[model samples]
Target: DEYLERESFETSYFSTVAAAQEALDKHTAASAARDNQSVTGSSAFSEHWDILIIHMVTSKLDSHTMRDWETERNHIKSIPTLEEFNSFLKNRADLLETMEEAQSQKHTRRHSDISHNRPKTFVLIPTTRINCEALNIPSHIKLADPTFSVPAEVHMLLGADLFWAVLSNNRINLGKNKPTLVETTLGWIVSGSIQVPYSKHNKMQSYNTVHCHFLNNIELEEKLDKFFEFESVSTTQQSRTKGESECEQIFTQTTTRHPDGNFIVTIPLKESPECLGDSSQQALIQFKSLERKFNRNSEFKQKYTDFLEEYQTLGHMSENTNPQDDKTSYIMPHHGILREDKLTTKLRTVFNASSITSSGKSFNDIQYIGPTVQDDLLSILIRFRQHKYVVSSDIEKMYRQIYVKEEQRSLQQIYWRSDPSEPIKLYKLNRVAYGTASAPYLATRCLMQLGQECTDKNVGETILHDFYVDDYISGNDDEQTLIQTCQNSPTEFMGEKC
Candidate 1:
């Protein structure tokens, strides 16, 4: 509400105007009552004089004061009044009507100007997946068995009609239940209900339902005809044997290549050859198939390993920095130390010490500088001589956990500047956060407070842990002690088995 008051001038002006109008009415009424039953010409003059005085005083006042007067005048005018008061209201209404007429004219003119300035027409181009598919040639394709040569031609003609229907209305009905070929194929592929054939020869080219539909589509054939003028036809000969019939060679001319470079090829074979007789032959074929599958798997694994090695090597080389700067450097405090008298009183009492750590002493105090300082400190401390077997733990989403103090919330607000047309907005911090320079110091202070509590409780005698934001590394002499310390800490490590 406070922010709303700041942004809207009309709201403030309306409130002030209302109050001023109320005050004027009260003054008018009091003056009229004082001059009651008096027929002197001075009575009318006195009333007008009082009204004029009120208006003058209100006009000279600040916006809030003027609004208060307006509010008072409006309140008093609501009551049954003298003839002269009614006449005054009628005149004021006429003035308001004139102002409103002028405002309405201005608004209409502005609206007309805006409407004329806007774009006359806009074309919305298709970009989404569904819209793109609607405009695509592949979506109109249909597939059939490659060996069915006679039916394939018939299918092509039917597919052309279906494609036209889809293009006209963006949908079609094939029968009582079946819809367009594109819809059926999309349903199968998207739902993962169709079994797609995996090809080891070409990973990029696999026989899926989508590919099957695309290949048989009439629109795709038309596109190929336009671009490539494909031609030529060829056939392969295959021999087949049947029961009680001597093994006879059949010269089957099965493949046909279209004029647009698109081909319709066929291979003569039983749908499931293993379903035939001869158990020993089927076993031998199965073993050979397994061997081929193993070979393909091994080849894929080797290629993947080579790719990983190259990727890691390139990543490391890119990140390689000068050794000297990588080493941690100690930083001195920027501000002067607390005075000896203040420190003796505050620190000595707080720490319950016989003597406070003296100021300006290099051994007693130090600070870490730079963005990577915390990471460096954690690494060095984990490897320190006094402790070993460090187990690192992290508070899940720690920045979102800590609450901001109510009084200091505004101090944490960030003003975000967007486009020029939109005003800058303030984002109030609802929780502790990163990215701000002061957040790290604030988080560290919170951790210190928690540490002080733990020390007071005297829990986990041999364990030593230090926290930096969400991350914590607890060190002990052995693995068991470190594990125990982690169990005692109030945190869930990544919500997994800790």
Candidate 2:
């Protein structure tokens, strides 16, 4: 009895395993059948698919179908599942098929009525022809295209499906290796090849080939040629102007270094400072306008006052005592500029040297802008990517760090007042003032001059080439090399007093 019970248990286990295997096979077969049915039915529901898959599939749909899909999508108010999309598509297909069937039946009935009512006759029309006199061909032959002899782009070619329909049973073969002329519904066509002929002078005769070019095509080619010229690799040096050369010479001759390692660069003037007229009236007008704005917005007024105070506190500007009313002394009008994106110092005062003075000439009009002295941003970025270790930092108050000549300080004077009730006073900037035409040249030239004095050649070269305006961006393949280079510079070469 115990043996029978054990055998019975063993039989039950084998049956359970067999049944499970069979169930698994059936489940897999059902899944495959459902997928196949969904594909075949066109409108049948499918399993849910990823939203990205749906987007890709929908992009391939025709305009009318996409419109319907959009309407369904709007009704759903969210991204539709693959099953829902399939159901919607199925309904659209059914409606379209029904309409097509109705249209086909209507057309068939109309055609039947016309066939019964109209006369049974056929009309043969002659093909279009052109004068082949320019080609000097036989008068009996007709040319299909008037400009066939002229070199032009072929718009279309007759495919195999239309070959027999256009071709006729007529053809004329001139001779061996000569082209054959075939008659067709499109008129006569020339096919095959011909041999080149020699002139009486024992040289290959030149074929009179005329090329037809449209105006737009000519314009397109001209534009393409210009694009190619701009894109072509060139290694020519940029030519410097006489004014630029003079500006460079002035910077080299006059630029000096202070005891604190700060550079003193003279303003590169294109015209004599005496050319400038009194700008006191313009400065006063601008001050009054700024006062009106300050009175309206308390927050803006506070920021503006703070900026000027900081500028003065940093010794970047000083009160101009015993100010002269002469051509050499021009007062610049300044306004506050707000930069919301800046984390600190969101507001700053911008001195407008371009403001027109009494003589109808601005200070900027008489100043040499000087040549761009720094490497372009593209070059800086490309070189930045070359190193395993990279570092980026910008000088603090770059322009303010450089000192301007004492005589030129009068030229950089500005009108300022803390409040509307207070009298506006003249203050002269002690550094390379921003917004002046020569400011960029002065600041950049000072940096280059400082770089020339560096003890390390590599550090000097990096400062000369890697710096774009105030920012320093450079790297080295070796980490230790980059560390050493950074350590050697920053304090003396860039970041500090220099």
Candidate 3:
């Protein structure tokens, strides 16, 4: 029994010794490969790695943990590899891992504490974005709110014609229903319904509806038309005389044009005319006056001769005779001269225009009154005094200088005859007539456009501000510069002199 036990113990000891020797040899080979100059096709070892292994037999009463061969057979006091004395530490990986876990737990707790203490925030939106598709809104609509609750007072304003409005989904729809134009006097209060979805606390009813007048649409339009009638003449002799007289007094003449974006002037006439209302009587008066003045009134004759020189019409009459209207005889509301006391008054002639012909169409209907170029008279006078030396001149027949387009001339027809025996002639005024509402607008608009086109900065600026009607007034600090502006202005703008 003792021999058997002994044999078994020997076998166990030898096997353990052999296994430890093999492990030692493998570790040595790896180290040798690292140190070698040409080991070829291997990168499995690092020269800087610090590696230590304990070669032990697990059987028997376990030996003391040791990393070196030179340690006591049962225990190791220190490592043997380094030149300096080395100490041994056990469970190194476990200590490092435990410390890392504690640090991670501490960071997580700190993050949770900060999150719990912080205040909450909210975002607000603008009124413009209530209809996202309609309005071109940018991203990042979320913004910091200045208030925790709604303001005590919020102001909402709507522009003209927008007083009657509809709001849906925080969006505003202005002038969905316009005000009723009842007559020339009472304006823009009408009845209408606005259909739309309602948003929270809308100012208007959930379904917006309004009402102003009780009259039917036709009656409303008719009554309104009477109050807003245009300048026109009649065919019957008596009506023509009465209409022309009324028309002569109706037009209100002023130099400044309002930028109404439309061309219509309201004239209210009240003074007595030099000639009677009757066209036949006026014609007789004109013919007699012209016959007597032709030999004696050289100035009158000169004007008449100059008018003829303009060749405003072919001596032959227009042949159009749709109604009682003959090509030779044109229908005009009235005839008269403007600003007779002014120096340029010699150039101003009355070329009365019929707003609506017997055919029921009106010339002023389609025309547009351009924006105002005339500044406030007080402002212009102030600007005119800006310099020491003031320069002034009158445009010669300003409206006449700008010719009426050929197609438009036919719209401006007139009546002319030398004597009772002569045929009453139909004549087309070749130029824009001063007596019409659009004349001032056309003349000033052209002049203003010309001024804008001027290249010289000073001259352009002067022309833009200096004029009122046919009158031109400007001033400059320098005499030569003023003279230069005066000289260049007329030449550059193709200005015609009286």
Candidate 4:
């Protein structure tokens, strides 16, 4: 009985051990099957799993959580001590200082180089007209209108004056040397026309005629010759001074330069006709022809339409509420005050009341003065209500509306120099100019003061208005109410209305 009981116990123990081993093997097989499934899913999925496993393994090895732990480990590894750290910090500070010094030196050198470069200058010449007539006469001149006659001599003098004015003006420095004369040839293609001033004898004699001919150099001639083929020269006669048969001649200059360039005389006609008829009619014809050409050019029309669409889109974008999608509008302020004294005093009073300072200086200490409380009043009024219909009015030159006071004129001094070598000269602002940091603030304050005054009067409710410098947008439910507000406002300088 004892032997049989011992055998039974041993058999039970072996069976239990075998069962445990089988369970362990099954778990291992399941894990391997799941991993194989994951690997076979997709290339991307397999790569991601590999990365995740790598990160998990890395995290377990040496987790650096705190500065003290890092320091302790460094110490164990015989890393730099406190004394070495302090030396390194000092060296780093020195390196930073050196870098800053180097940067400053580089900036100074660049600035010096820029300053040494010669300043550029440009010259502009007013265009003039030259008449081709009063020489010899030829037959078969194509006349547009019988009533019109070309002026022969007056235009040449005008052209000469223009040319001389451009040459003599020393304000424009054309590099180290002036432009040398290349070649001066008469441009026979009539550029533009002007109405001749009436003589004392008859007011009816005034008529439109070709005023000038463009004169170009050899460079321009070569450029013209590449494209244009010479056409022909023809002329006609016109009666000039009284009984003596004066022959007014004209050179019929034509070119096949479809890609237009500066005018060149193809067939030089010695004698031409003064009676080239009405230059206005010829100009109209040319304009019509141009219009037709422009209409025919599909690319140009498409581009123009595209440009207009873009412009409209931009305009709409600017008017929209979304700041990110909108275009920025620039404000340009005019200079000079229409009523300097009154405006200055009004602005000063507003500034004093608000206790506003600019650039860490009191209003009195500030050099430039602008609208103080008026802008705020305006902004509040316009923004008070949103309307379906909005119309904006602009004061032609608002800054001029403010009059500078005689007493305050001396305090409103601004100094500036175009060049470093030049002395800073004080400039008295006669008008309101933008770009002063304090100007907007002052203007807003002034608007606020104005609003208060209006509120006290109980004339009308302040409307919603937005101002970006000079540009103001006023929105109102009633157009008539807006008009009335503008009309009732006392300040009408520079034609600013409600």
Candidate 5:
């Protein structure tokens, strides 16, 4: 019985699609005429889609339903405002949800073996109606529930193939993965629906849903490389004159090398360490926040101490020498309580290289944001969303895991004190500090190298392709395969295991 209802919904959806296609064919001449009048896309939609967009936007002019083509294109000739059209889409999405729920109830009555009272989960694929209708991809729209509500003008110029590619990929991905989501999300007991965002969606409890997105046939890396040429050295200087910012020049001149060849920047020497502006006070605030949290959870306090001990053992930080005339020392400002839930200052009082200094030069101003070697995030997300089973974890203290040569440690100085009366003690970070301009590039480059060195070929490939910084998000058809892949990774003596 449930199968029959699903089949009927799919049939209805395809029938509507056919109706749209026919309407487009009939109005091809009218659509071609619209070319001179500036349509939605920079390039006009191929003659057919232009007509279909108009029909979707103005479907109600002559009749409530489009049984056949409207005699005159006059009905939908006037374009609706983006807001007005969006409202229509919301109404459409709600209507579909209502229909789906009604059908589910009907199916429940006939299927005696299955529980009808299970929670419902929905994966939203909301876009404008035109995005669904006019965009071409020979995908058969299954009418279980679709929630498109974007502006009509936006969809008018969109191509059919692009639209079809996006929608089909998401549908196919969700169809493959739905069974994998069980237990905690109540997937074992609940039926999932694909939808557009609806108003009543927030009211439901015990609802667990994840979005699926389009994965293009072409690799993202290839597409990005083709679009944005990143092979050359690009400078940030924009025709500098008399008083134009010379921070870049200062940074280059001040940039030095340790005996071990690690690049180092000495604070308050060639490059002056900057104050954190309003954020400077955060150090005090974060200290108090931690103090307060310690009073509440002693266990958390223990974790914090253990974390610090682990950090020191990793050689990420250590005590600094006495203040000397030749040595440049800067009081690193700590703020925002280095917290999650409460204060978890990953670094208590670390040099804030990002802060704007008195000379109006920030540490970030001097550094080169090295060439981007990472994959596009959208590409990763889309690919990740497509699988039946997915595993996402983070590498503990990613930046700290890598070592900074001893000679370069002075560049990342900090000030810390146990109490207000206690004299602040100076320290030097022995590893790459967070909030530095090059941290992301440096860390990701190392990660890619690690991926290359990994023994498990499949895991190595996934590490290179799916990781976004410390976060590892990847998908597979089987859970055990994913676990095995992780176990084979080259994570020896990991300080903070993800």
Candidate 6:
């Protein structure tokens, strides 16, 4: 009810500029009428102020002030009233004034002899994992990051100026198997590695890299050129491995076109899928964990549920109606990935085909990871730069356009439910799943096959050579030819419009 009320207020009053202006006028008139009443003070006006406009006030505040506002607001259990916000600001103003007066009375000092040899930018040290528990440092000391045993990529680096400022003169050594503790304003940072007894299985390897460049060395350039030349596709006809050859042969033998013009391809299995044991239990556990996340975030839950519904609406997935034996069918766990940088798709549902089943073999482990069938990125980019007018576009839902064979669909089953209290439903992916190892190869191979059947020779050649996976990147010197190439070659492949 609260959610609906908030949505109604926002939609009615703030959906357009005219509506917002009318709301402002109404509020202004209400304030004026309230002032004329028998109420005694300014508290009457604040108490009557609309709480929805509080965000507008906070948005204009400085970072520190906004953080303080949030801290105070979080302590309130229910929706904070307008009067409470006004009272918070008043108290914040008084506190700032007191701090300013106290700071004004303090003496200022300057340092003259700080070292100039300090680095302008800090670089990461690719250090081995440091064991914090083995150090066994004093109880009074606090580590900067408590879970240092788990490796983490560094997000922020302190420069030389801040580095020296934070450093303290205190240090402690806790013998051979333990690391030393260095004191800093942030916390005590554990330094160095621990030693263990000699064993073949307990060996640690450390690697160091040093970079050197000779700018005007002719010999170096010639050697580098020769090395790249030897590795080039034009110079070397790379031999195919046994697995890759088998995978290609299977794809050729099993691929078929539906009457509707959709290309259906079998899952390239190196081993039988029967080896995979029942994975429904594992998938159920993962589904319950996903439900816990949904319980905390209603907005995220709505978006995720909407995505699944759309997938089903597009015929990418369908509920399994038949009772298939557990030995032949495989269940896949799924998770959501959130990419804030994306403009359209902020959340993506990805199925985990590599999850280990009860038989210790995953669907991916039994299937052959087909060899790369598309042009490399560097080659595509090089060819892309040669044209006078460049154009690039990628296929929408490229993998989903191609259908997996009906026999192979059992290997891609998933368990899902909108709510935790609801009975779990079984569904099978109808199209090629994105996370499967053979998906990229199968999708690209189909495009190559389409290119082979094109009636226009020039358009046919462009489709063959210009594509990198599903992306068509190419151009011609003439604008008309470039536009014509894009129009004729890229539309209606495998029953899908580009």
Order of models, best TM-score first: 2, 6, 5, 3, 1, 4
After superposing candidate 6, which stretches have Cα over 4 Å from the reference?
A: 1-234, 325-327, 487-489, 493-498
Candidate 4, residues 29-64, lDDT tens digits: the string is 344345545665777765455444323322432222
Q: Model 4, clash count?
A: 42
RMSD of every candidate to native, in Å, equals 41.9, 28.9, 42.6, 45.1, 21.0, 31.5
Poorly placed runs, candidate 4 (over 4 Å): 1-385, 403-408, 411-427, 430-433, 455-470, 482-498
Clashes of 5: 6
Q: Report the number of clashing residue pairs per model.
A: 33, 0, 14, 42, 6, 0
Evaluation by TM-score, superior candidate among 1 and 2:
2
Model 6 Cα lDDT, one tens digit per residue, 1-498? 543453344334322433333344344334434433434344655554445346556665655456656767666666765556655554444222221111222223431222212212234333445454555777887777565555444433333455556768898988864556777777777665556434488874433321111123556546655665565333111334789889999989999987778789998999988788878889989988999999887878888999899889999999987845433798899989778899988999999999999999999998888887666666567667666799998888889988999888989988878877888899989999988888888988888887777676666666777889888898877999877766755754323431
Better of 3 and 6 by TM-score: 6
Per-residue CA lDDT of model 2 for 1-498, tens digit only, reads 543454345445544544553454344334434554556454333343335445656675665456656756655644566566554554343222221112231122232210011111231111112223422345687755544543344333232335546777887875664556677776776654434446576453333221111123555555655765665322112335789889999999998877876788889888888878879998988889998998888998999988889889988899987885433788889898788899976887788999988788998999998988776675567557656689987777889998998888999998887866777788999998889998888888788876777776776788787789888898877999878877766646554433
Q: What TM-score would every model get versus the actual structure?
A: 0.21, 0.54, 0.36, 0.20, 0.40, 0.53
lDDT of each: 0.33, 0.66, 0.41, 0.31, 0.46, 0.68
The best candidate by TM-score is 2
Where model 2 places Cα greater than 4 Å from the true spot, the runs are 1-224, 232-234, 325-327, 484-491, 494-498
Off by over 4 Å in 5: 1-310, 325-327, 336-351, 419-422, 453-456, 489-498
Worst 10 residues of 4 by lDDT: 112-121
Count of backbone collisions in candidate 3: 14
In Å, residue 7's CA in model 2 sits off its true spot by 71
